[model samples]
Target: MIGANSVLTLAVNIGIAAISYVMTIRMIPRFREMFIKANLYGKDLCKKDEKVVPESLGVLIGCVFLVAMFFFIPIPFTFGDAASAEVATTGGRSEVFPYKEFVELIAALLSICCMILLGFADDVLDLRWRHKLLLPTIATLPLLMVYYVNYNSTTVIMPKFARMFVGNTLDIGIFYYVYMGMLAVFCTNAINILAGINGLEVGQSIVIAGSILLYNTCEFLLQHQLDAHLFSMYLMLPFLAVSLALWKYNRYPSQVFVGDTYCYFAGMTFAVVGILGHFSKTLILFFIPQILNFLYSIPQLFHFVPCPRHRLPKYDSNTDLLTISTVTFRAEELNFIGKQMVNIFRFLKLISWKDHADGRITTNNFTLINFVLVIFGPVHENIVTYMLLGLQVICSIVAFFIRYPLANLFYDT
Candidate 1:
């Protein structure tokens, strides 16, 4: 027979799952109503005066309620006889386990709350980018404090040359704090950016949640680390709940968007969990796609790329010294060259292109690149596993680029 703790866990999981399903069913009509109202408002406003239809109040309220409920359910860490006995048997630090679990759960809940608030503000009031950035950073303070208190310090990975040149210093205090802050911000933004399309962000979250669960399971099995497993399980429950709820409204022709709430929380969850579980390297490997997406989108955010003169006709010739007209190339020629560059990027499978007619083309040449990188990437004891990861990456890349481009072209056109 299962112990009381095990039975409680089973009950909690079932209750949460049932609540999620019921919430999803209840949310569908509300979502549909919101969608209809928004559409009607959008159409009427567009006819009279162009204005964006504001996101529904119902959705915002629902998100807030969910976030509140998550916090309200305080699942206190039980450092009971079993846990104490286990610690004694393993000769492990006694205080660390319960505290770590507590911190992680609190961090996850805090992160969720932050995301809900930020998401609500963005969805309803249409917050500026600067505010979004600043707000989330401010909101991440609790999680950061919890992390520092529990972990004591953040880990840093320096390049071999840098390490050799600088001599290993154990005292990285303020730097660690700043690094952690930056990580939280970056992850929050990465998730927000990737939430552009239906299922994309949610799918990524599912992948992350699954990877963390697997990693935690492995840690427990191999090292007899119950803390990691327990923390991961707690984190997974809410994520799985939210994913199911969001998926119902998010699956293609999305009735309701998870918006920044889900995105920010997803990123925060990954960051906090990784830090607590000491799975930084594995998390990095698992979230490579998100990393790639961030890398690709960073330049666009800065508007660093030079625009041709013809693209900006209002610029004074004298003031705008960087105008394409001042150069030898014509605007038309530059445009053509730009198009070619895009096509070339697509050909290389480094980027994607959407033509005016809605045709999409993506390059699939990166499969070989990924394979080579994997083969030479890490000297893992489990060479076969690394080999398999390489193969999966290559296969996924090829399938996505080759088929998606065609499908996108067909549907879009």
Candidate 2:
């Protein structure tokens, strides 16, 4: 049940979240000039005038979230202890620490800290693509280790249709653990690769976090694993607070860039909540757009098609509109297999492309930002961002539908 103490703790956390929001908003303006002086600035490629704005300000959210989490730790443990003190005294079971929960909390914090460090390093060093993709795997090890130590449920339910062939569940053993690690990597890179336009990254983050927060609240009220859902809520509230603050300036007609730092930290934060809350599958549903973006990008990612340095939409200075960018392929550069894959993409109309008179081919880059541009045919930046945000919202609704009503048809409750 949702007790008085739980309600009180939530109120206190809301206060803390509000303060985090204020701190982040104030810090952004202050950090702007300092960062520019340090040459940590980027040209707004989407803008007509191309203003040089302070970049990598997303590290601020990481810092503020960390600080809030550190100072706020005592509240949860103390309150839980206070709530159960009478049982401890009367039952004479003796005092016992909530050791498992404590370890989980500490592990989550340490893992997030590692991601923040890695993200900042990427921004400063401009590491290679290989390092960029694989370093997050290293950062996720702490989380996997803690999961293995604390609550290692390696079994998963079989779909109702497949149950007759096997059984109700399958013990996947170590492969389940493998899936968790890959989730972390995918989450980090998914957010990174889907971004380019102003406010798109942070805006999508807020939508996903908010959707998870909503789900947690529902699960808590339904009294199904209240503690786990509460654990999830604590992490998400502060994230939304900080992310909303960052999004304010990062949004269309942007004032600041969120940088790779914010994306990594934000992705890892979602991963932590989903893993610790015991809802990783449900968490993934909210990422439909990201998943689609990745699938569309497979050809370019594997080098079957030529991938540009930046796959973001192109800006038309004269029209002040952004159009979908393209990847170019020359016959000599592509192998047989690559050419086949490219032809498959074109035949399916999965992409829009043209055969140049100069014996070259050009096709739309496989990114969600550009995909949206292709659909709408070059609109205003604000309009494109809003449409993407709307898409995120719609995906959340679809996720809930699949999780609840639709899921009953596929699996046992």
Top candidate (TM-score)? 2
TM-score attained by model 1:
0.61
- Candidate 2: list runs displaced more than 4 Å: 81-94
> Taking the tens digit of each residue's C-alpha lDDT, what string does model 2 give over 24-108?
9999998999999988999999887889999999887899999999877878767763345233333756764566777777888
Q: Which digits, one per residue and each the tens of the lDDT, describe model 1 over residues 335-398?
A: 4545555455456655322333333332211222222322353222123223333444554444
Candidate 2, residue 243: the lDDT equals 94
Note the residue pairs that clash in candidate 1: 349-363
C-alpha local distance difference test of each model: 0.51, 0.87
lDDT of 2: 0.87
Worst 10 residues of 1 by lDDT: 320-329
User: Which pairs in model 2 have colliding backbones?
Assistant: none
Query: In model 2, what lDDT does residue 117 have?
Result: 93
